[model samples]
Target chain A: MTHTDNGFSATRRLILQGASAVVLVGLGNLPFGLAPAFAAANDKYPEEAFKAKSEADAIKALYGKTPEASDKVKMDAPEIAENGAVVPVSVTTTLPDVTSISFLVAENPVALVASYKIPAGTMPSVANRIKMAKTSNVIVVVEAGGKLYSATKEVKVTVGGCGG
Target chain B: MASTIRVRATSSGETTEVQALIQHPMDSGFVKDAKGEIIPPHFIQQLTFEYDGKPVFTADWGGGVSKDPYVKFAFKGGKKGDELKVSWTDNKGASDTTTAKIQ
Candidate 1:
């Protein structure tokens, strides 16, 4: 076993060198590693739709008026979210002649999360999970028969979801 | 890969409706871990509903959405005992299909 110990040591050194080279190459390609801590700050949505902190603010931003809750729109969400990263939500409506459906998170950086255009003769319902930065209200706005109806449910986000 | 997708359809005299929620991780590229690495975008990109092998509804999505995406849509001609199949594909090329009988 000791006959070629010199060769074995040389091979071992070469293998270690190659492994370090691979690691260096991998780290060099990671743009996130090179940038300063402040350089990779989180980007905010450009649209003004998300800044609303209250239900009234969100509604005023979306419809130009504070929304009055009606029985027509129904919003469903967990009372206490175990994980704020993804909170499941569903909105259904019994309103007649629904035309559109939209969802908003009152406290998110941008309140307006998603909006769907329901085609004619189609059901006006949407189910989606949204990111909640904190405990906030999830609102659903429905347009039925050319009239807008809304609903809200308070969702408690115990942990941060937006890369906190 | 051949598991049956469960879909429930209900009709309230005037309109036929169906609702479905699939288990998926709709990762938007914007999400980052404690290490500050940008998590590549992974989201449901395609979804389709079929009734007896006939296409009924289709949807396309982007990374602006959240995780575990849920979608609800309705059709006019669904009836009790009809078969509804739903399938989805994520940005990473992973796919899942499920089906349920309309009741």
Candidate 2:
């Protein structure tokens, strides 16, 4: 378990320079005075989005837009999860110019499980483990070419992950 | 005093696939304890992977993530022996960063 503060100090500039560059898709204008502030806003942890209890509100807060159903998005997950505490889920997309990917559990206390920012040169695919409170649909959203597209699948949980 | 992040980055000539497993409670604040007391929320809020000083992947996570989170992804153009930096910051302001070599 070796660790160091070295990585944090070195990457500080890069994080502050902020890769919210992907979200710059629709800001339209960037004034000199507000440039720094705007960039910071893009990189900051999306507190509100993660706090949203409903799937719709979480997506709106995270992307500020609605997604259309897309066949291009492919999601893989078990039809039944015996342990809701750790459900394996993965999403991959054939959509071009994808900028981000997000996963949401409609029945979880916080609907938004995770949102990933995809920088250029990175593949538009991700795999992660999420908690499910009950039998519910898991939605995966992919933001490609400045538009949002989504796909969902229902996962039956034998045990609730939140211990609810 | 150990790093909570473990990462494996492998390059297959053209693209590098990265898999990371992090240690954290990821408590959603909705769970109860043996005494029926609610466990307060504590979870990693953001995780980033960088190569050549550029961020290739960034994840914004919530309490819904499982304990000791694991994530996998890939990026183009990383060569063997090159370095990849993985770091994470939690809701409580605790963070750790580790450097792994692409194999």
The model with the greatest TM-score is: 2
Model 2 chain A poorest 10 in a row by lDDT: A21-30
Q: lDDT tens digits, residues A77-105, model 1?
A: 99999787778887888888775566777
Q: Give the per-residue lDDT of model 2 (tens digit) for B6-46.
A: 99999999999999999899999999999999999999999
Q: Residue B25's C-alpha lDDT in candidate 1?
A: 62
In model 1 chain A, the worst 10-residue window by lDDT is A38-47
Tens-digit lDDT string for candidate 2 (A16-99): 556565347335444553766654665789999988999999999988999999999999999999999999999999999999
lDDT of 1 by residue, B1-103 (tens): 5442345677665555777666666665657777989877677666677776555555445443566566667766667776788787766778888777777
Fnat for every candidate = 0.36, 0.92
Q: Per-candidate TM vs. native?
A: 0.56, 0.86
For all candidates in order, the CA lDDT equals: 0.67, 0.92
Instruction: List DockQ, one per candidate, in order.
Output: 0.21, 0.62
For candidate 2, the TM-score of chain A alone versus the native chain A is 0.76
Error of model 1, residue A22, in angstroms: 61
TM-score of candidate 2 restricted to chain B? 0.98
